[model samples]
Target: MAEPFPLAPSLWATTAPPGPETPPLTESGQADVVIVGGGFCGLSTALHLAERGIRPVVLEAREVGFGGSGRNGGQVIPGLKYDPADLVAKFGPERGERLARFAGSTADTVFDLIARHAMDVPHRRAGWIQGAHTEAGLAEVARRAEQWAGLGAPTRVLDRSETARLLGTERYLGGWLDGRGGAIQPLSYARGLARAALKAGAAIHGQTPVTGLSRSGSTWTVTTAQGARLSTERVVLCTNGYTGGLWPGLAQTVIAANSFQVATKPLSDNLRRSILPEGQVSSDTRKLLLYFRLDHTGRLLMGGRGPFREPRTPRDWAHLERIVGKLFPQLDGTAFDHRWCGRVAITQDYLPHLHEPAPGLLIDIGCQGRGVGLQSTMGRAIAQYIATGDADSLPLPLTPIAPLPMHAFHRLYVSAIIAWYRLSDGGIR
Candidate 1:
């Protein structure tokens, strides 16, 4: 028998507030909606749907938030992975403008939910900073700020002195600051969403892996590995990077890449004062970006791209230590206390993908490493669509699922893409 998904030994696992637990489904049952995966997306969808008096049964392969939702860097950044102007150009004027606004306002939705629910997480709304790795990168961020500012977003481009003051590092050329940004204890937030959903009458079953999906007349049937089954009028897949071949071509639509994270021992007050004095979460402008922030406990958390397979911790974390030394010379001797890695989905367009693959079947995947805010906002939109049956109210237009060409070569493609990004990061661009 296959083992259940293992809960990652991340800092969040030890620190997150207590979460709700549901036993595995043991017999046949029915619901108005069945949400696959118990990460932030699924929990948020359940919460929203239940608020509207819709009963949703959420099935988790392991525990809630066991995947990237709990293992992520915790930086609540707004917008898609791409720039706003590029989004406008790709999606067109009217559609693009709406997308840009949607991206910019996502963080607001996350913070509001946290406040309304009184979630027990370290929630901070100081801001999010994006540092430029080069002069050209600085210029690009300036343009990005201009484009978002035109849409009434609270975005500002920072010059070298300002960036250095905020980040306590002279390595960056410049950057931009989005005042709407913030950070949270990701696992706690995920659990909070589950609790909220439970309050609204959503049933969540853990250790319940959906093995098969089949349509029986007007309803969809979800078969569990333990032979338990669930019938529902609507089915939603929020598995994201951990998505498998349950539905034909669903997993093939996005590339799953590994992201590794490490946390340094708590810094002294003096050191903390010198580093990120404003407590803003930050990332850099690179093909494979570098993101870092200080947790509420004052530990400096850093994350970056990593190998696809299970990583050898010591060797993998050595790269991150060197990066910290380069960025903050004062942290030369800082010892890392925790290290972990998880998969994050990246779509071809570098944006979240919403698909209505079949009648009454919807799939939401592709986080692209900017999921904290985007996924929560998307969950609300999905619930609205389910309740009102209005496609126009969705955050992103639902499209038909088109499997990636040469899907079988995804592993090789990811390897090649990583090499290219490394080369570009090394100044060969």
Candidate 2:
């Protein structure tokens, strides 16, 4: 039962809107459903559930968006680590097609929700670019573009010249653009979701951590660290990277790795016009990828895999700073305004997991570094299944939680793998 690292002083903190008022749960009461964790998934679940006239209650360990939802790079890229064809090959046509469709349009789910709610979050939907660092990388993105285009996605392959023009960097050999993806001020989006959820009659309790839970036949009971109690017929565990031992063996199901990020101060007008001029986010194809984008205000942000343990020094972000200069030499002496990190849950098979370890309890965990869009879509699907009790309504079927063997040592190996990948990717020492 470990707590998450303290919230990082990220760029989002200065830019995001104020969180809505969320009073704590005082008296013991029963709810139609109780959701754990108040990141993107939990708030979206509460919002969608309340829209359906359900009395949902949300219990958050910290203020809303205090975890990865607020700390991530905010690139709204769709699809999973796997491609559409691979999804069909692995899960078969029936379930695979459904999963592919759900995964592909996850970005749409976020944009649509923002439009439907009129959330005043700064966002853009130009596209997401996958830069190819090697010839093989170019082939891979071309294949990805072809597969997604066949599925009617507005994806296209980019030659070397086109890539250099769009990305303002010749570091990539070539790449592809998936027009369905985009970027956002992640913390602002999370706060907006909380506002919409509260307006829809949902009850959210911030700083109320669920300490333990027990079930008796049809109902489940949860106790919080604040000495409050709640009962519900259904409980949804939306904790992703910050998951603890709230449920038996749940924390061990995925490896929570750190994704470190840095944001530069607003660039000069010439630099801004030269870098990511069209406003699409870009992530290169490397063992440990480098993802970057230009915010609407012209600040350049970059992120990548980092230390397994929480960062302890400014040196933890030196690699990203060097990589930025390598990619955009014009930014060599630019000053960085923010540096932070958050945990991203990586499942065994690199896909989102839905588990029903017990009756009347559902769990959604693991995002593989794409939580913003996937979790938003997952919330709507989980809400539909909760309201209707139809497993088919869910994008993925319920699976048993299978904790990784020797899960305690994941960090040891994960760190080693990251080191090897970093070396292979090639950069300053």
Candidate 3:
């Protein structure tokens, strides 16, 4: 087995403004709703419910945003991994249109919340770019732009020269730009959400790992490893890729994948100006994808798929280092100051899952690396569902939790899939 890789000190952890400290749940408590997990989804749910006068108690295994919420690349992507046409084909016309509209509104939701709360996190709305890494990739980008534009999304296709100028490299054939998208300091945003939720009258507990969940009558009791429990009328489980066996079959519903990132120390002014001059965040088209952006401190962060097993050493980011070197030879010797990895859940259909296995039991999982914008938006949607008890108002249908077949072999299967993607990525390049 790979050695356990715990969350490490990341660029966001050190640079972003610190959030208010929250006390752990020491004794039993009661609230209208209990949210398990303190990442973006849980925190956002708590805030929205509190806004509706519903006191929510959020429990986190560690500090707020300790999971992929704080660890992700921080790009506020405007849509799902799949395109608008795929959504239409999958859900038919009406539902697909709603989902696509909701997807496009994610960036607006994130920035609006930040402004309403007067958050001080480093943020920018320059735009989001999806570069085409292969000849076929350019066609995919155009198709996506065309489809979303037809649906009134702020999308535009950039030819090869424009793509190269925007990204500062000729590694792409062309790309698409989503004008509604942007970037932010993820950890700072998570912390800001926590503070806002607290001010709105939500109880947030850190270091409170939920051990068991059981229902009695209409009240659901949540037991924590710290011997603290809470009884509430509803429960929202927001533990995505880091999901364990807390609730039976929840973890098996999606495959967990590792995404690793490396950040270089602040670059020189000249280098910064020459690289990604427009301040837009970008990710390329490849099975083994590459996402990168400039931090507030001028640090360049590059992210891609990591080893299926926990990284035994920092050398695991060497592949990312090679990509950076090749893409921008001027920064070939630039030293990486930070390297870390986090799990992102991927559903079979590549769409975020909204599961309601039992009465008062709700789950939102499988971000597919689009959690930064999607999670917060989904949290608010889930809160609306809990407040009004209207499933039709949600972006995605509240369906039964369907566990994958032969889930016991999921680890092996994921390993093989990663291998295939890596090989396919080489062919694309």
Best by TM-score: 2
Candidate 2 collision pairs:
none
lDDT of 3 by residue, 149-256 (tens): 987878899998998888888778889998888999999999999999999999999988999999999989999998988999899999999999988888999988
On lDDT, the candidate that comes out on top is 2
Writing each residue's lDDT as its tens digit, candidate 1 over 38-116 gives 9988999999999999999999998888898988999999888667778878889788878888888889988999999
Evaluate all candidate structures by whole-model CA lDDT and list the values in order: 0.87, 0.91, 0.89
Clashes by residue pair, model 1: none
Pick out the ten consecutive residues of candidate 1 with the lowest summed lDDT: 1-10
Candidate 2 lDDT tens digits, 1-429: 544333447899888778888777778888999999899999999999999999999999888998899889999999999999999999999989889999998999899989999998999999999999888998999999999999899998999999999999988889999999999999999999999999999999998889999999898999998778898999999999999998889999999999999999999999998998898999878879889999867899999988888877788899889888988999999999889888999999999999998998999999899999999999999999999999998888799899999999988999999998877774532
* lDDT measured at residue 238 in model 2 versus the true structure, 0 to 100: 90
| Winner by TM-score between candidate 2 and candidate 1 | 2
Query: For model 3, what is the error of residue 16's alpha carbon versus the real structure, in angstroms, after optimal superposition?
Result: 1.9
Decoy 1 TM-score against native: 0.96
Please, what is the TM-score per model? Answer: 0.96, 0.97, 0.97
